[model samples]
Target: MGAETNGNLEFLSKIPEIKFTKLFINGEFVDSVSGKTFETIDPRTGEVIAGVAEGDKEDVDLAVKAARHAFDHGPWPRLPGTARRKILLKFADLIDEHAEELAALESIDAGKLFGWGKAVEIPGTAENVRYYAGAADKIHGETLKMSSAHQGYTLREPIGVVGHIIPWNFPSTMFLLKVSPALAAGCTMVVKPAEQTPLNALYFAHLAKLAGIPDGVLNVITGYGTTAGAAISSHMDIDKISFTGSTEVGRLILQAAATSNLKAVTLELGGKSPLIIFDDADVDQAAELALLGNLFNKGEICVAASRVFVQEGIYDQLVKKLAEKAKTWTVGDPFDPKVDKEQYDKVLSYIEHGKREGATLLTGGKPCGAKGYFIEPTVFTDVKDNMMIAKDEIFGPVMSLMKFKTVEEAIQRANATRYGLAAGVLTKDINVANTVSRSIRAGTIWINTYFAFDKDAPFGGYKMSGFGRDLGAQGLEQYLQVKSVVTPIYNSPWL
Candidate 1:
């Protein structure tokens, strides 16, 4: 390590060492039944950070059993809403206290920028927890009056044991996206964190326990998706499964749930999100949004605006500005207080495909640094709708630029993809913004900004991108089941 890298690592070493690498079950850290473990490699240096227990079918069963017990009989699910809120608030506070430790773990394990991981991802996660904590006591059912000689009402109750299969990218955010709402809804859970980034989730489980979340209310199992993930999906006792990953894997999870007990499944899958810039929009602002939309988090975001559509009038100007701006983004170590091998290879391959397929490589198109999985921020112009780069989700720091002549054509081109997770429009004209915003088929659309995520807004995708919302009251409902109660009016003699 260089002097600077050593200084960064030294700062991280001051925090407490991670002691929760093993599987957490019923509030205790224990070895997997099979005694099998997997090495977690740091993408920056290709070094083994830690050996995490590999949870499989047997381990999943144990976790499910514990979650079921917690739901059916433990104090956690039976606590009052105010009580749950208190515990969750405390949990959020504890996460804030250990923000540096959590952020460091995420950076080394997932190759996310240490500063961004600490400042953005970790803090955002804590905010998500606080949002859900405040929302816990606010959740309520409904009352109704029947026309007939009967009175009726509906009740929303916790959907017992929930299974959360989290994705590797944005591990901290995704974990809270699945767990916080379930916590608010009085449901116990079995979480299977992606093998590549399991440290933060295990550490979060410890925080939950410290916050007085009872035994069996939360369990973290670290393993590959096929074994632990498959077991969770097919477990009969699990009331629901919420997953965030690739569309292909989302389909498999759906099949597993259907063939098993038909557990409720909510998925937030792949995206090839488009950022449309019209002629009337500010060219500088449009260029910056386009750059951030694709380059943030090294372009590992699920809703990354990879497919950029520019109106013909401003096409050349915006493309040139974005190309210039793309050169400024630094890519290297994720923990030098800053910023994959398979993922690296995949992104480089896409850049090559962009060149071979006839898209103009306007800027960067090669790897950076002598080592590590670093790719230069790349921009491609003259991209056609039929090109592979435009059609596929190249989850990297690559931007593909295409053009449309009119508003109608822009909307059509934006909605052409099977993936409709998110789309962005840059226009100062209210009429144009309104028309395009409503016309686009994406689950979330940004009018002026590219990515403006908040806990209050509900977010998901349409078509092949998957279903269900992950934030706000809509998210809490995912962990609840609704039922109706009826009472006959004796005086009215109605049955």
Candidate 2:
């Protein structure tokens, strides 16, 4: 089933209505095995917008069974790479065609601003699909030189059924991130979306079918993480599990995978990344990049620059200018045409936490208005490295600015966190940038810019942020298994 037409923009004067409430299994909307459903509320207003199917262990079993059956005996795995590429390209085209409707549903479901959702996230999803679609036909195998009198070669094959668990912050993007590559690699999948934001995932499953994805090749299961998520992690038939969420849950998934069939696991977990600004750096440019890096998506980003380490020479000036610019950011109802609501409330909540945790509120710490989940853009200065705001992943629009005396100190402080997901450095000194980039430990690093992503680049983490890359050629490798083949060229006398 598709989104209900009741919530069309023309009907905005009326109350928002439920658009979807079923799980997608085997290419159709179906009920959970236990017949239980959970309410998906709009975080902005704390109102229930729809009730989604609550899948339990039983449902996970069915989904895994479907995926396994498809992998073992379906046309998806047997199809040529060119054939898969054609279908995936068609899917990407469909995503673009319905971009507006999908963006609206995502905004209403996850409390993101409609404009940003439409302009950025939806298009990013389509790009990811198309990238993998083209890459599908390019996966290759290599020949190996034999030490003995035998010819040998390696074949890259689909790993089999995959289980993907996505987070709430970027439901649509993460869905495409995990599903597209798996499909391109000829593996079927079952997805378990976060309970807080499940609607977009269900809608995507419908779009997948519309794009001609086979039944049982893709499924969406919605339920509490402890039940459905845990079941997927521990399923024996699931050949792989790709997760994007917290580090704690990533650990649990690792344990579950180890305890079950030893499925291959790839995790894109938490981050408290750092942004370093040198004395010679351009203040205006640095300030803008810092704001976008930390405040994008309301700072609900895993790779957000939560920690800002500025060289002492420019620290005070950058901090002041940043705080000043932050005050001008509009925070109000996400649906309001004038404001960016996606990150407003989340930013405000982090501001509140900063105060409670005794962080020195530099500026912009209060909500701007009375309606919606709006919070003033906030920055904390004189934040010690040990402070909670500095150490933890405050996935909101709160930035912590700390001063560093040297390049060594900046690299030391940047690498101090358990997370090594992403870090940014702003400097005109090419030598300094190269030195610091090598010193700091993170999966991705930005120089003078932040949040730069492309399908050709591999995305992931280095430490507690979790392992395995998400995009590029390496991303496709995550869904493949390498097998070596050898043949004897001469008959043996012993035989």
Candidate 3:
């Protein structure tokens, strides 16, 4: 460990101080009620970055109480939409102003690349905040056309206290994705940032206060999922919950919500997405896209194209192109942003399983560096439909490449797995694109491209991948409740 992290030394110089480690409740940074703490490890050096407050059931309860009070009796809900919008705009401005610090913190905490965090993640988070802030004043309900002789309308009101359980990958992005819409909808929330990467969320809480958000409106509790997350899911005061993580955890949240006050739940769960490259597609471009789809975010993406199906004619050519394009992907941050040790071991284990299951390793099946949890970009060829690597959501930089003779076969194999989160179809023919994209059983399908996410476009998963959306006007729908109001006219039939 002594000399293995020399690459990180220069980058470490720019890392921001690890401040705001305590639980953020009622607009104040405070320790957990139980006074316990957990270590947040830096993935690059395998070193403890800082000790953060470990929120348990008691902490979650306090967060819930504060959020409930804010929603029920505070000014956030009663304030005009424009007023809320103004505050949120200021919040976005603050995020933009501190983009560098936030990016550095993400790098130190989550092993995320500083450049990408600075250029894309940080600014993109601010953009989403602004997007939702603009929509704060535009939430509208339709004037109902009643069948009877009466006047009727619908009011879209904020759903009470909400619980947002964000995943570690892309913490800031997911933060804005869930919190911004709820904030715009005038709903108070208790947030449980993933324990592995909780620093950014805590920093976000600090920024929220600086932007003049009312006390108790947005509270963040950093702790393990079994305790804090489970408490949030089952808390009676929390009217709704939005979670992004594994399907296994998602089911637990659903059960907790059902067993409690029957809180609304929105889950954006895991995926074993497929990228289909047809014979008619551009070989080089498709290969590059396949690399991008598999390795983007170090292959930690929930929507990663871990399964790649290539047509029979161009399979060999595209495979070579894919390996060639993979060369450019090697350049990035010093340590790839793996969440923690478990993930690193898990990725290595998946690679081992891929080899044992008869899938041929095309390239990169081992660890990258001596120290840090870095798995090399791995690709396996001749992957069968039934193999674990092909079916399971490995959540790593491992790709399973297979060959299909026809479009029907490709589509069949793409939708073979239990996941229906996302998929990519690469084809020059419009008819093929239309047919394949429509046939795949996924919530979002990209044609000739991958990861085309936007703030205006709603995103979610299908089947076991979970329900509800996280962006666009629909993203805010989960945070709001619709109530119908009707009044009979003087000449109504009832009168």
Assess every candidate by TM-score.
Answer: 0.96, 0.93, 0.97
Worst 10 residues of 1 by lDDT: 331-340
lDDT (CA) per prediction: 0.89, 0.85, 0.90
Off by over 4 Å in 2: 1-18, 337-353, 356-358, 367-371, 491-495
Pairs clashing in candidate 2? 26-216, 344-375, 345-373
**Which parts of model 3 have CA positions greater than 4 angstroms off?**
1-10, 331-336, 493-495
Candidate 2 scores a C-alpha RMSD against the true structure in Å of: 4.4
TM-score of 1: 0.96
After TM-score superposition, what is the CA distance of residue 225 in candidate 3 from its true location, in Å? 0.3
Error of 3 at 425 (Å): 0.7
Ranking by lDDT: 3, 1, 2
Q: Which is the leading candidate under lDDT?
A: 3
